[model samples]
Target: MEAIDGLIHGFGVAFQLQNFAACLAGVFIGNVVGVLPGLGVMTAISMLLPLTFAMPPVAAILMLAGIYYGAQYGGAICSILLNLPCHPPHAVTCLDGYPLTLKGKGGTALGVTMLASFLGASFGIVLMVFFAPYLVRIALNFGPAEISSLMLLGLLAGSTLARGSKLKGMSMTCLGLLLGTMGTDINTGLQRFTFGFPELDDGLEIVALALGLFGVAEFLKSVNAVAPVSTSATRIRIADLWPSRSELRTAIVPALRGTLVGSLCSMIPGTGPTIASFMAYGLEKRVSRRPQEFGHGAIQGVAAPEAATHAAVQGDFIPTMSLGIPGDAVMALLLGALVIQGITPGPQLITEHPDIFWGLIASFWIGNILLMVMNMPMIGLWVKLLSIPYRYLYPSALFFVCIGVYSVRSDMFSVGTTLAIGVFGHVLLRHGFHPAPILLGFVLGQRFEENLRRALLLARGDLSIFVTRPISLAFLLTAVLLLGAQLYFALRRRDEIQLPPSASPILDE
Candidate 1:
């Protein structure tokens, strides 16, 4: 009943002209962003963050949220038609999507992808509708100790679960924490890590860091890299778009399973849409009787991963909104946006600012519908986007990055900082180090530190305070177990690698 009432109130807010326009603009840009190779949704959102300063908080959030999931709809277009994954989450789609294209069923693959994307997003939205409110209620019981422990768990999970070397991820996370410490200590008036630069007193501008790492750095890395071209992609016809009834029936179970996988992944910190899509594809292959068809134009391959990606993308908001714990880098950026807008995210968010929460949820339904309608009719246009030269795209995108960073403080220092970080980020990218974990660490580090300080203060510096509280102890234990499991797996794998060939049953066989 509450959910129903909230939805009704939400629709009233979403229908407002300004908010509606923001959602439309966001989804449209997101679609284009997703169709363009090398430009991620994170980069797009980061670049646009400064622009939201003048907008209403609810509308700003609606727009940014639109971009995140709307990208899911457009990503498969490139993956299916041109064998390119504009979005990382859709990379798995390229396996079967491109094969179907080669077999002249690219339209069919796209149709299935679209259907799966819609269904997956719908499922995620429904889950959030009923789940987030209850989560908020449970979180209201948490105290400083529990909050701090939970934050520690989030940091650890994000670092370890990010897509890279766990050691490197942890190192980057520590680096982020160090960066977060650059500003004056909240409790103490003394400054640290300023290095005598007055600009450092306020700490690093998130706009600079986000734009530098995700936007400018990506542009620098992808500037010279060439994308594979597909001539047949230009020939897609509306008539060839729909799959047969049998294929639709075949896709239903996998799509549902993928949605389930994505929803579950969303609840776990650090795992996001990209992981969900890959896991879904793997699951589908294992369950299929004709597993051999998986990479050879399997409809299940197109459906499952696309479904999972959309589902996970939408579900990613649950943790961010309900617990104030961002599940991934993108969600962290969104959280920053909320902070900038003066809207605190957490259990009290639903009560204090129900408009932002419910309105954003309502916008999801509206945006997804718009995406579905726009994508099907405009498939040809998106395919044509593949023909656009990288030279034209990267430079244009960098221009916006520079402008956005500069706009934040109207200072050249921010632009220079962005460039410096971009160069460093490019170096990291070259060495196979992901910058996402860094952003996660940087965003969550402050909250962790603050909560830890408060918790200690409440306990009069007693370390046992954490363990005395069952919830706090549980979170700490989870963090420890996560690290232990990763260590155990690492050592086990190393041992297996070092075993003598004669001692292996596989070698004897």
Candidate 2:
């Protein structure tokens, strides 16, 4: 009943004319960015965060959250039409999605992806709405010791979650924490690693780093090589718009299965769509009547991964909005936006900012529906965008990277720092180090440090407080168990001189 009232109030807030318009605009623009490779929901949301300075919090978050899941639906358009995944998780969609395209059943694949995405997203949001109350209550009372232990668990769990060696992941996490430490120590107010450069005082902008790492690097790689995109597609007509009943039935079970699995995995910090899709795909195959059809344009294949990814996208918001723990790059962006808007995301946010919370939740259903519309008949426009050649696209991308970086605090030092991070990120990329764990660490680093300091201060530097707190102790023990299991597998892998199947799928690029 409390959940119902919150949802009702959310609808009340979201129904305002201006808020409705913004919701539509956000979802529409989300599709545009989603179709464009590298301009993820995080980039789009972060770039647009400043624009919401004047808008009501309800409208701003509604639009921002709209962009979140709308991208999930819109990304599939490119993955299905072009072989390139719009985002990495959409790469899972490309597995069977592109194959379906080759068979000229692309229309069916797109429809299934859209429907499954909507349904799975809805499922996740419903769970979040009801579960948030209980979750938030428990999360709110967590002290500094509990928080620090949670961060430690998240860090170690992330090491096992992300690609590469546990040691390498630990190294990357430490490096990110180190990099994150550069600007100024909040506690001491002293600059550490400025290197005497005035620009180093502000540290590196994530936008520039991300733009270069994902946006610019992708452009550079594309410029020198040919990427696969279908040129012979007969523009899909409306007559073939909807999926057949048989096809819908084929997709239902996979979508449901994906939703169930994706929701569970999403609660784990550091895990995201990459694992969710793989788990969903494996689940489908395990229960499949025709398991051999996977990777061969199976509708279930397309539906399962798409559904799981959508659920993951929505479920990822759980930690971000409730516990103030960012689950991914996009959540970090949302956190920044929340702070900039003077709306802190924590346990009290639900009670203090009910209008913002509910409004954002309600807009999700609207944004998802808008995405379905965007990806269908309007897909023609999105696909037409792919026709714009690399020369033009690269310069435009470079412009955004430089401009977005410079726009933040008018710092040229940020641009320079970005280029350095980009180059370093590219090096890490080549060396098989996924930059995600670093991002996770950088986001959590400051808070982790803050919590550790606060806990020590509160306990008068007594380390026994962690062991005395039952909640903190439980979290610590869980982290230890997870690390022990992960280390065992890692050692076995080293002895066999082979990578884990989950970490490296031979079929992946």
Candidate 3:
């Protein structure tokens, strides 16, 4: 009943002219952004954040939210048509999507992806509507100690579970925590790590950091990479875009299974759409009678991952909104945007500003419908978008990166800061380190520190406070278990590598 009433109020808010227009514009831009290879949702949102300073909080948030999920719909286009996964989450789609294109069933694959994406997103949105309100109620009971312990769990899980070497992810996370400490200390009013620079008092701009690491760093790496060429695959007919009844029957079950996998992954920290999509694809292949057809244009291959990506993308919002704990870099930026708007996320946010909370939820239904329309009838328009040359696209994007950075403080120094960070980020990429964990750590570190200090002060400086409370103790134990399991796996894999070839079980087989 509470959800129903809140949703009713939310629809009223969402129906306003400004909010409606914002949602439309955001989805449209996100569609274009996703179709482009180098420009990711992170870059699009970071660049556009400054521009939303004057917009109403509800409208701004609605627009930004649209971009996040809207990109999911657009991401499948290039993967199926050009064998290019512009978004990392869509990379799994290329395994089967491109194969479908080679077999001249690209349009059919896209039809399945569209159906799966809608079904997946709808399932995720319904989960949020029912789950987030209850989650917020439970989170309200968490004291500083519990919150601190939970955040520690989030940090550790994010680092260890990220798609890379655990050691490297941990290193990047530590670096971000160090960066988070650079600004003035709120409790003591004493500056730390400012290096005598006045701007460091505010620490690095979130916009600058996000644009530098994701936006400019990706640009630097992709600048020299060859652009995908158009082939006969681009000549897909509109009539072929609709799947046959047989193909639809083949896709339905896998799409549902993928949605379930995605919803589960969304609830877990550090496991985002990229991981979920791959997991769904692997799961489908394992369960299928025709596993041999997985990489060679299986319809299940196209349906499962695409559904998982959409479901996970929508489900990512639940933790960010209810717990105020972002699951990934993209969610971190959205959290930052809310903070900038003077709207604190977490349990209090839903109660204090029900309009923003429910309105955002309502807008999801609207945005996803709009995305379906655009992806279907306008498929040709996006196919044409693939022909854009990299040379013209990147330089133009870099110019906007600089401009967006400059717009924040009206200073050239911020722009320079972005480029410097970008250069370093590119260096990290070259060395096989991901910058995503860095953003997650940076965003969560200050909150963790603040809660730790508060819990310590309340407990009269006793470190045992974290273990005394049952919730806090449970969270700590979970983090320990997670870390231990990861280390055990790492060691087991290492030992397997060290085994002599003749002594290996495979040799006996």
Model 2 poorest ten-residue lDDT run? 221-230
Judge candidate 3 against the unseen true structure and give its global Cα lDDT, from 0 to 1: 0.90
In model 2, residue pairs whose N, Cα or C atoms come closer than 3 Å (at least 3 residues apart or on different chains), thus clashing, are none
Q: Provide the clashing-pair count of each candidate structure.
A: 0, 0, 0
Over 4 Å off, model 2: 46-56, 199-228, 494-509
lDDT of 1 by residue, 1-509 (tens): 99999989999999999999999999998998888888898999999999999999999999999888877788888888888777789889999999998998999998888889889999999999999999998899999999999988988989998887999999888988888898799999789899999988988988899999999888888878866566553588777788899999999999999999999999889999989999999999989999989889999999999999889988999989989999999999999999999988999999999999999999999999999889878988887877788878888889999999989889999999999999999999999889998888888888889999999999999999999999999999999999999999889878887888776534321
lDDT of each: 0.90, 0.78, 0.90
Q: Which digits, one per residue and each the tens of the lDDT, describe model 3 over residues 125-158? A: 9999999999999899999999999899888888
Return the number of clashes found in candidate 1. Answer: 0
Measured against the true structure, the TM-scores of the candidates, in listed sequence, are: 0.97, 0.91, 0.97
User: Candidate 1 lDDT (Cα, whole model)?
Assistant: 0.90
